[model samples]
Target chain A: AQTVTQSQPEMSVQEAETVTLSCTYDTSESDYYLFWYKQPPSRQMILVIRQEAYKQQNATENRFSVNFQKAAKSFSLKISDSQLGDAAMYFCAYQKGATSGTYKYIFGTGTRLKVLA
Target chain B: GAGVSQSPRYKVAKRGQDVALRCDPISGHVSLFWYQQALGQGPEFLTYFQNEAQLDKSGLPSDRFFAERPEGSVSTLKIQRTQQEDSAVYLCASSRRVDQPQHFGDGTRLSIL
Candidate 1:
């Protein structure tokens, strides 16, 4: 079974600064996908970014990017120039490859992020 | 809809009562999923549907929980004799295909009193 672990229970970052959220996972499958999702008070989960296991290059989406170290099974999210709106609960997720014939997402406990002024 | 839509933004039901949560996936999404998220916790997979067929239900916690997608678009998760432990936010997600990224709904907050 694949499990995702988010070590930080809560994190704080000053507005206009940068912060990184750590995430690690354990999986036997070589092919899979990793994702970061942000849930605001509204309770809607918004996809931040995603990384494919086979892709050596990390995934970057504007101010959001991921440091995907496949060998170490570590996928971390880096938020640059954080804003007050960045405050939310972030979750890391894992999914098997397309050919695995599975469509369930394994999510981590989540890390609450607070952007300080 | 443009994204996943869940009905009854909030639901309050007494213990032993039955509750049904609805989910409307994207217009043409082929894969839909249901997840249960407790307070201050991440969402946990409850079931999965591919079109009109429920392909995986291994994550369902007990026999009291049931979900279905008869027309491959609108889905419902029904809980029989709801318990206090069943109180949580039920989220629904959908993707265009099995390999695509999923779009999540705002979720239905179910409270048991």
Candidate 2:
């Protein structure tokens, strides 16, 4: 079974600053997907960004980006020019490739991020 | 609607009672999923549906939990003999295809008293 780990339980960043959330996983499969999800106080889980294990180029979405290190089993999310809207509970999730019979997404405990104005 | 929709944004049920949560996925989506999110924890997979077929349900905690998508669009997750441990947010998501990125609903907060 694959499991995701988010070492940081809580984090805070000042407005317009940058912050990175750590994430690691254990899996035997070489090809898979890693995703970062943001859950606001509204209880809406939104996908921040995603990265494919086979792609060496990191995934970047607007101010949200990811540093995916397949060999190190680490996938960290970086938020640049952070705004107050970035405050939320961030989760790291892992999912197997299409070939896998059951594509169940495994999520980590999560990290609460606070953006200070 | 433009996104996945879940009904009864909040639900409260007494211990040993039964409760049902509804989810209406985006039109034409081929995949639907249900997840349970405990406070301060990440959402955990509960079950999945491919159109009208239930391909996976191993993540369900127990047999007391049942889910179905009869028309392949709307889904229902029913819990029998609810317990305090079952209190959590139930999230519903849908994807264009099995391998596509899924969009989640606001989720229904279930409270067992």
Candidate 3:
């Protein structure tokens, strides 16, 4: 079974600063994918970024980037130029390639990030 | 118009009652998934469907939690004898392909009283 772990329960950052949330996952499969998802007060699950196991380069989306260390099973999210709107709960997830046309995702508990004014 | 949709945005049910949550995936999407998200937590997978066939349901916490996707497009999650612990936001997602990034719906908030 694969499991994602987010050690930080809560984090805070000043406006215009940068914040990083740590994530780690355990998986025996060699082929899989990792992702970061953000959920605001609206309770919508929004994709933040993704990293493929086969890719060596980290994935970035605007101010959101990931530090993926496959060897350590570590995948972390970095948010630069943090804004007040960035306050939300961030979750890390892992999934294996589909088998029989279906796949299940393992998700972390989540880290609540607050952007201070 | 292309995003996933979940009906009955919020539902309140008395304990021990039955409830059903619906999800409509994006058009042409071949994969649909059901996840449970408690307040202040990440979503947890409950089941997966490739069209009409339910291929994986190992993450379902109990036998009372059942999900079905008929015709490979629309899906439903049914909880029998709902308990207070079952109160949470139920999320649905779909992807174009197995490994593609999944698009999610706002979710159905289920409150068990």
Candidate 4:
């Protein structure tokens, strides 16, 4: 069984500042994928960033980036230049590799981000 | 629609009543998924479908819950004799392929009174 853990239940960041949301997972499979998703009040989940377990280089999407440590099983999202719009619920997810024959996502409890102006 | 679309943004059903939620995936998406999210909790996988074939339904809570995607593009999740415990937001997602990133819909909030 794969389980994702988001340690921070809530976080606050001043506008234009940077913030990091921590995430860790436990999975026996060596090949897998990690993801960070944001859900605003509208209730639609938007993909923020993604990282492949085999890729040593972290994944970065514009202002968002991830610190993916395969050995420690830690994948954290760092939001640079945080704005008010960045306030939302962030969730970390895990998925098995393509050859694993399954496409289910295991999600963490989520961390509520509050961007202060 | 350009993205996955779920119908009846909100639903209120009395206990013991039956309810159905609809999900329309992307035009050419080959894989669809259904998830249940309780208040203040992360979404949990409920079922998965490849084309019109339901490949995995292990996450469904009970026999009262049923889903079908006969035509492959449109899917529906039906709950019979709804209970208070079943109240939650039902989300739908789709991807170009099983290995692709999933695009999620706004979700349908179901409430059982």
Residues A6-58, candidate 1, lDDT per residue (tens digit)?
A: 99999999999999999999999999999999999999999999999999999
TM-score of each: 0.99, 0.98, 0.95, 0.99
Q: Is candidate 2 or candidate 3 better by DockQ?
A: 2
Q: Sorted by lDDT, highest first, which candidate order results?
A: 1, 4, 2, 3
lDDT tens string, model 4, B1-113?
78899999999999999999999999999899999999999999999999999999999999999999999999999999999999999999999998889999999999999
Alpha carbon lDDT of each predicted model: 0.96, 0.94, 0.90, 0.96
RMSD of each: 0.6, 0.7, 1.5, 0.5
Residue B58 lDDT (model 3): 84
Model 4: residues >4 Å from true position, as ranges? none
Candidate 2 per-residue lDDT over residues B10-90, each given as its tens digit:
999999999999999999998999999998889999999998999999889999999999989999999999999999999
TM-score of candidate 2 to 2 decimals = 0.98
Please report the interface RMSD of model 2 to 1 decimal. 0.8
Ranking by TM-score: 4, 1, 2, 3
Residue A110's C-alpha lDDT in candidate 4?
100
User: Taking the tens digit of each residue's C-alpha lDDT, what string does model 4 give over A1-117?
Assistant: 899999899999999999999999999999899999999999999999989899999999999999988889999999999999999999999999989988999999999999999
CA error at residue A89 for candidate 3, angstroms: 0.5
Predictions' DockQ, in order: 0.91, 0.85, 0.78, 0.91
**Which pairs of residues have clashing backbones in candidate 3?**
B51-B72, B52-B72
Candidate 2, A20-82: lDDT as tens digits: 999999999987989999999999889999898889999999999999888899999999999
Residue-level lDDT for B111 in candidate 1: 99
Q: Which has the better lDDT: candidate 2, or candidate 4? A: 4
